[model samples]
Target: MLNFLKKKAALIWAGNHVKKTQDFKLNAEIKQEEQLLMMVRTAEKTLFGRQHHFEDIHSIEDFQERVPVTDYEGLRAFIEKMKKGQRNILWTDTPLYFAKTSGTTSGSKYIPISKEGMPFQLAGAQSALFHYIAKKGNADFVNGKMIFLQGSPELEEVYGIKTGRLSGIVAHHIPSYLQKNRLPSWETNMIDDWEAKVNQIAVETEKENMTLISGIPPWLIMYFEKLIERNGKKITQLFPNLQLIVTGGVNYEPYREKMNELLGGKVDIIQTFPASEGFFAFQDDYLQEGLLLLTNHGIFYEFIPLEEYGKPNASRLTLKDVELHKDYALILTTNSGLWGYSIGDVVRFISKNPHRIMVSGRTKHYTSAFGEHVIAFEVEEALKSTVAELAAQITEFHLAPQVNPTEGLPYHEWFVEFEKEPEDLNLFSLKLDDEMRKRNTYYDDLITGNVLQPLKITRLSRNAFHEYAKAAGKLGGQNKIPRLANDRTIADILSEYKI
Candidate 1:
């Protein structure tokens, strides 16, 4: 009777959430504009708001004019002040919590998480599952265990504000009712080392009737690898009812074949674009070409054309006017007190009716040193095509631009750790190069004209990246290999690494 009630309640909530999301899709444009106005009104008295003359902003153009485009570095002073308990700096009140995430230059970033703003992230989580349940008409997963491979819930005080990996903080805040169906335990999640935690999770969950699994692609793959190794059988053999495999945090294309192979069958894969800054988008339709932009979810968004990026004065557009197919750098003016903030991600709209978008890459996460610009999507797509053709399995990988004066023509360098290395490595590299050249005309022209060297591959002696992560103290919990870098920092470090 209790189980029945729990399942019934979950279905009801899921139904309600699904309907709510549908409503959001209908009024997304007007609703988003209204949200933008509300954020300005509510935060108009705050330091950032007052300084930017938020109260005087009657239009999007005015808002854009008053507030210059800002990145994490640009907002560091205010963030640092917030860490020391400064009130009414960005948001109206002191941040109840601070979400810390890995930074390219700063090592880690502390983002203010307000009480009202926390729900933005939670709404995305619930909506993803609810949409899945509603679309598939399957609620059995609600009764079964959900294994979210995420960070430990443990947090440290960042100048009196609670701070930790966004995953950890979210994990610790999972609603109590849902907690009954989630694993591994808080104790296991608290384990700092990722490898050890995976082993522990495998031991604990190998016997559970898990029906849902959600995580970043690479870590989820690691967990599957450990579970299969420990039980000496397919993951399905251990939990045959597993029906959903939701992933985010990194490109899933290259990892899909291997993850599917581990499951021993094709499981439903849902993509979400949740980040430390905000839970921005989630996959809604069956085609999976784009994610439903959560436009009404207390976040006001803007987009800057990729071509106009880093210009002396680039144009920024609100959702009221974004075109399909053209890449744009995403900007946010959120309920979290972030105003005119560039989260470093780039995306392109695919559907304006429902406001669906595809995350392309980061503004900084591209290689254009030689004018042969290539983004993460291009790299991952190239790798996905090549790896599929070669039947190669990857554990982890990183890429960097190599432009040493004496090292011949500049080339893109790949440091890959393979679970199953390809049969012919040279051909594997060539196929990867060929795929990129096909996707990017500039890259093709550079190579065709002998102005650039072909993309190079260095298959790392196992666990090379892992060892580096451990040494860097990022062994677990939302840590990811930087897929593309502008310089040779990571590549050079790996070059000196021994087997």
Candidate 2:
């Protein structure tokens, strides 16, 4: 009865507020600068704020002129100071914790999550759930347990600031009552070894009333596969009430067909775009075309055209200035005291009315070798189409440019670790190359110009990715395998595992 009442109340709250949330986001262009000004005022006394003279920042123009765009590297000095007992540094209050962003361009990064920032995170989460409930017109999802498949919450302290994966931090911070329907209790969630944790989760959740599952695609697949192995049936058979699946952190195109096959067409999926820097967007539309950006959610956004990034005095456009279908590097000046921080993600706007975006790729994770630039989305679409045509299953793959002068011709080499081998290797390679040409005109032109050879694919034995990640200390939760590389470093490393 209590669970039913809670769920009923939640349904009412979600129904009541979802429209207001959407209305606020629709007016983001009008409110962005005002919100940014308020943020500046709130953080004026912090170390970074005082260093950059936030008092003089009366308008967006003033704020932009005084503060420069930065990534983790640019803020490392201040971060080190904060780690070494500096009070009220980057954030107004000393951060309660830091989220360790894995798979860094340089190295691992620990982003400060202050008390002031917690509300943004929590609110984003609540809104995501509410949006899901409202969009699906169902509040019964909360009546049953939802397995988040989160990272371990055994936080490590760095100079009194607790540090761990973002999912772990969120799990640790969610209210006690909310944990009633959440899977893997604190004792289970604190297991540092991922395999052990997954095994425990598989056993524990097998009999629970699981209606929804959420995690990165790969980990979710692993969990489902484990359940299959343990129960001798599909996951939907085990959890007859399973209705929805939520995914983030990585693209779902490659895994969609296989996951659906595993579930026997028993569930719907909602895609999300979340990061340790902040919760950004989620899919609400029934068609799942693009993510609805959380524009009114305490974070002021800026977009630098991909063509203009790192150039001399590039124009940073706000929500009012951005247009549809152009690739832009994401920049943010959040309420959490991130002043014009570059988030290292590139996105393409799909809609301007309510502001929707699709994450294109990482800023540094693109291939322009031989002047044939290609983004992750194009590559992903190509692979998705090719896999569908060939009826082969792919577990994991990475792309890199092989550009050695002595190698006769430069080519984009794919390191594919397949679940099921293609019938014809040469034909499969041709299909991949053709897909790339079909999606990217520049790549097609380069091929026609004879500046590059055909795309290359080096097939790998099953589970090569797991072995590789294990060797590199990145096998566990929240550690993503780098998908694209400018150089052949990842390619050369994967060469040893070739089938």
Candidate 3:
């Protein structure tokens, strides 16, 4: 009876919350303008703001003209000052926490999470759930166990502020009302060894009514594998109530087939676009294929044409300027004091009615050897289509260019671990090549012009990715295998595990 009342109350609250958010979605342009102005006004006296003449900025053009677009390297100096307990280096106040993440360009990046900005991050996540609840008209999941596979909550103090992975920092902010339903135990969560932690998590939650499982898709797959191995039963057979999955960090389409098989049934999924930078977007409607862009969240957004990314005169565009299906590099000026920061992601607007977007790829994570410029989405789409046609399942895959081959022309090398290998591996490779050519005109031209040969697939041993990640000291907790690489660095390392 108590659970029933709680669920009923939750449903009511969700309905109201969704309605409120709809208003903002409808007025996204105005909301964004307001948000930008508010942030500028609040941080006008800060060192970064003063340097950029934020007080003189009265319009989007003024702000854009004053602040130059930049990446992590551009903000490193300011971040260093903040790490040393300096106040107002970037924002009006010092940061409450620093979310630590491994960087591709640098060794480590510490992103500030200010007290003023943290609530929006939490709100965005909560709103995703509430939207799901309102749309599905179900809150039964709230009454059952929920697991968020994450980093250790134990934090180190950098100066006076807490410092840890974004997931770990978020652990401290889970609402008290739902605390009892969250898992695994504190001791299990604190375990640094990912394999050991996953084993403990599988044991701890196997008997519970797990309804919502949330994490990056790869690590969640690992946890699912652990559960099935230990119990010799499919995930749903053990939990029975498992219904919803919330995932981010990487695209989910490539892993969907395997995830469904592990679940033993079709389940609802909410794909989110979250980073240590901020929770940018989330799948608000299960029927939709794109995430609703959060214009009213404590951040102002800008987009630059992907093709013009590094050019000196690259156009900085607001929401009104974006076109459908056009790729843009995502940029931000946030309440956390990230000014005109390039988050390194490429996205496409699928809908403008409520501003829905699909994360296409990354600015830096692509294979451009031989000038073909193969992107993450193009390769993933190729693999997805081929898998569907061949009725095969992929455990994991990575793409890298082979600049020189011992016996043949250079080609794209695919490292794939298949759960269900096709009867004819050669045919599967040909089909994948065909799909790739259909998607990327540059790649097709290269193959036809004899600059590159058809792609080659190298089968990998089971758990090859696990071995690679372990060797790199990034085995779990938001770590993901790079989907595409320009050079052979990842390819040569993965070569050692080839079957």
For residue 346, what is the lDDT in candidate 1? 90
| Model 1 worst lDDT window (10 residues) | 490-499
| Greater-lDDT candidate between 2 and 3 | 3
Clashes per model (N, Cα, C within 3 A): 0, 0, 0
Number of backbone clashes in candidate 2: 0
- Scored by Cα lDDT, where does model 3 land? 0.92
- lDDT against the true structure, per candidate, is 0.84, 0.84, 0.92
lDDT leader: 3
Model 2: per-residue lDDT, tens digit, 1-499?
A: 9778977888889888787786666788888888898888888888898999989999888988999988888888888888887886777766788888764565778788877776777777677778888777777777788888888887899988898888888887777776888887778888877778889999889989998898988889888888999988887888888988988888888888779877866687888888888888888673567988887777899999988898879899998889899999999987666778999889989998888899988788888876676888888889998888998888899999888746678888899988877898789999999999998889999889988889989898887888888788776676787788787777788999998
Query: What ordering of candidates by TM-score runs from best to worst?
Result: 3, 2, 1
Model 3 CA RMSD to the hidden true structure, in angstroms: 1.0
Per-residue lDDT over 179-252 for candidate 3, one digit per residue giving the tens place of the 0 to 100 score:
89999988898999999999999999988899999999889999999999989999888888888999999999
Question: TM-score of the candidate numbered 1?
Answer: 0.95
Best by TM-score: 3
lDDT of 2 at 201: 91
Candidate 3 matches the true fold with a TM-score of 0.99
